[model samples]
Target: MNVDFVDSAAVQDLLDRASGVRTEGGDARIKAITRDLIEAVMRAIVKYDIDESEFWRAITFFQNGAPEFGLIAPGVGIEHFLDLYMDAKDADAGLTGGTPRTIEGPLYVEGAPLVEGEVNLTDDADDTGTLIMNGSVRGPDGEPVGNAIVHVWHANSKGFYSHFDPTGEQTPFNNRRRIRVDSDGRYSFRSRMPNGYSVPPGGATDRLMSTLGRHGNRPAHVHFFIEAPGYRTLTTQINFGDDPFAADDFAFGTREGLLPVPNRQGDSASIAFDFRLQRATTEKDEGFSSRTRATA
Candidate 1:
């Protein structure tokens, strides 16, 4: 007893009108994309026979999930899909190689204190859990990109990031730093070993994840935004290969080249990795994305 009226002229006209097909205002690209999205939604409503109760409940979930919507998008794999889509486009355009790009989670804050030499990512970290990570940045031809700026951030040992942590125990830029590479294209930092964290219990994202039979946990990881002159800015992160959830990241941040094993010795750990950047053809490729990010 499924009623299928999606192909009817009446429904088609409604979709066109909503996209403002007959109007003289609005951008054409936006209208076209909006129309397609609405059409898909309409089809889903009819195909699944979604009841008013279910529909309104979904709406209510989002209405109260303003703080979590951004996180939810990544948790559900949409953000990762964007990365994969862009990767395909780049490959098609003969633009490949260098460090792989991954989704930049929503926790990055602008204007971190820049340091000259070996930087300490966390100022008050204990010696027992100190992590010393070193890396070298090189261009595609294997030469050093000594002028690069390595932007790094990660959660504290308790798996809570500053600014976004609900407990408010962390100070501004508690585990964030902007380290300049040395003349040899090397950068190093000392930080507290970050912990794997989960979503807020009983929140909108958690509830939806539970409904989908998925766990909301990200492995111990560190984010990076590396940019140098004449090179494309790289947005990537490294997941500790030893973490249990490293391969099953909820944010889909883990990738082949980005997972590095941390060597634990005594009370501290050490890790090292190298990065390679693709040459930038335009000035836009050498800068960070204009996407809105947090500031502290």
Candidate 2:
């Protein structure tokens, strides 16, 4: 019988040479890392007695699922990274807070109907109440922001938005309008005070929230997306004057400056508020639309 010894260095040299082979314009480092990861996964599959077909299926699932990770990043908490970075830059320049920023929800439609002065947003005939929202857009120096476009939308008195409510009518996107501020940077609108709304039952987002043991209810609030040339777009909400959730918004959008003092005179309710926008220096700071049109 003869004992044979293998040259470990020769095998290592072969591996080192194979690792240098380029794939998809990737260098040796990437190729080596890819090979190592593949080997580790294969070893895991063998050790765990995972089904070969299921293993490949899981790989396919992960290949498709990985992009969703980006949603959690820039679209979610990871966006705080950029926010913190910007805050640091502002702090260095001694720019303190004027208005707190909030997440821009995906529901915002582009290019909403533009109106002058005021418009009624309440939809149902049964809904009757005197609610007035008046505000002016301002600059950093507290100067009026002329010609500002203020987009306002909210749920109906029943806590149901138009597009989402199957029982609602067609025209007048319920509680949604784009009003151009006057030369004095003033705008007002009339609508019934909207009720607090819960997230739709049995949806992807709702399911996730339920699994996380979280309630998907947003406090009664009015949604506003204000924009003007040479200014940053401001997306925010003014909580209901007397809602219990005012201090406990599920979205964490409530800020000290966002709370509006309700001024009620007889049967009419009024909210006089002011918004300050950051001046835009670049072409990208122009503005964004506030409407959504469905495709046939």
Candidate 3:
């Protein structure tokens, strides 16, 4: 009688069989993605010879930490990874000349007031140095993209976000607003320089970061999601070059050309930034949807 013990090859074969087929209600795309992930996981399990107890413990950890995936993904560089992948794809497709994209974080809220051209972002008495961000929206060919919608939001000086913080309850969307570019493709806004923020100290996200010997700090920056007809939707952030964590963002979102050097004049700091969007060449590009919002 001949008997063969389980080996790495055997583990891989088992995973292939388990993940190759889609269940009754499982979508094809979901099945395909899970298959690849399951195969990689099997390889890790076999390579590390992870024991049942250890494997289950890790599973339980993730199960508990699932709610903090938004924080965890950025902290673990997964968000940046996706952006890099998209950037590579764009380069391959000759889609160039636009503001560099960055992670959107998890604090976006719907229904910020819509105003034409510009709007003030904050009215807090203690708001830090006033910020005036003015910019023009252009296409890859250097033509202005008129009527573009630019949605902007940022944390307060205390590193808290409107609609998601106790201090913001009194002023929902305090630092959030939507501005439309005029015929000249120009938009501007006034707000205080937002402070950098960190993950909640004892939250699941922070717990995992601690276990992994990592920090959860995001540098001071403002978020923008730009949309226009016949152009790719752009989601990006402008990092302050002078932030202490500018070069060491926990989310790995810092990038060259995305950092703006603020020009301090008198009591107000002003930054002149320009955005160039890629021409829409695909259905997804033509319909630039925000991850925070669903298409009607």
lDDT by residue (tens digit), candidate 2, 197-239: 7665664435445766766666777878888888877766788
Q: Which regions of candidate 2 are displaced past 4 Å?
A: 1-89, 92-94, 123-128, 168-172, 264-268, 289-296
Candidate 3 vs. true structure, TM-score: 0.88
Each candidate's lDDT (Cα)?
Answer: 0.89, 0.66, 0.81
What RMSD does model 2 have? Answer: 8.5
**Residue 30 CA error for candidate 2 (Å)?**
15
- Candidate 1 vs candidate 3: which has greater lDDT? 1
Best by lDDT: 1
Using TM-score as the measure, the top candidate is: 1
RMSD of candidates 1 onward, in order: 1.4, 8.5, 3.6
lDDT of 1 by residue, 114-190 (tens): 99687888865433488899989999999999999999999987788988878887888988999899998999898
> Which is the better candidate, 1 or 2, if ranked by lDDT?
1
Q: What are the per-residue Cα lDDT tens digits for candidate 3 across 1-296? A: 11122345775577556775534655778767877887677667766778899999989978988877778889888999999999999899877778898888777777787888567988565446888999899998889999799989888888888776755443777788889889989998998767898998888889888888888888888988899988888888999887888999988889998998778775567889999888788768856445554111
Clashing pairs in 2: 109-291, 110-291, 111-290, 111-291, 112-290, 112-291
